[model samples]
Target: MTADSILNVRWRKASASDPFDNCVEVARLEDGEVGVRNSRFPSGPALVFTRDEMVAFIDGVKKGEFDGMTV
Candidate 1:
């Protein structure tokens, strides 16, 4: 879904985001899913993920499974 289409939701970014807001934002959707979008493109398309999917992704993140990819 498009980020702008999911009205009335608060999108949050990481606390360590740059001053220019170069980071992704996430919001809890009405249907218990999660919406993720780029902070630089608020009106851009958002990827909707189920709660379980989100949980798995977060778990992987905590485990550093995606580490070193940015480099």
Candidate 2:
């Protein structure tokens, strides 16, 4: 969905986010897809991902599948 389209949606940030609000926000769209955008850029471009794709990504995160890149 376009960035403007989700402007009114309820976006949420991770519970662990710092007080400075430096984190991404996420929300579930009407079409069941997930919306993700940078908290620092509320009106910037957003990326839409399917449920399954998000699940896979989340699982990978839990398993630290992308840890190699961070090291």
Candidate 3:
């Protein structure tokens, strides 16, 4: 969905985010989808994902499946 479509939603970032606000923010869309966008660009585009997709992604994160992605 377009970023403008979800602007009314409450976007939140991780509490552990750096002071520079260089992190992604997430919000729960009205249709049960999850919206992800860059905290540094609140008015930028966003990626929409289904509930199940979010669950899988979060699960993978907890399992360290993306640990190698960082330098």
Worst 10 residues of 1 by lDDT: 1-10
lDDT of 2 by residue, 1-71 (tens): 45667855799899999888798888888888899988878788899999999999999999999889757
Clashing pairs in 2: none
Candidate 2 has its poorest 10 consecutive residues by lDDT at 1-10
Model 3 residue 3 lDDT? 69
Quote model 1's TM-score.
0.96
Number of the top-ranking candidate, with TM-score as the measure: 1
lDDT: the better of candidates 1 and 2: 1
Q: What is the C-alpha local distance difference test score of candidate 3?
A: 0.89
Candidate 3: pairs in clash: none
| Best candidate according to lDDT | 1
Error of 2 at 37 (Å): 0.2
Return whichever of 1 and 3 wins on TM-score. 1
Instruction: Pull out the clashing pairs in model 1.
Output: none
Q: Which digits, one per residue and each the tens of the lDDT, describe model 1 over residues 1-71?
A: 78999998999999999999899999998999999999999999999999999999999999999998788
What lDDT does the true structure give each of the candidates?
A: 0.94, 0.85, 0.89
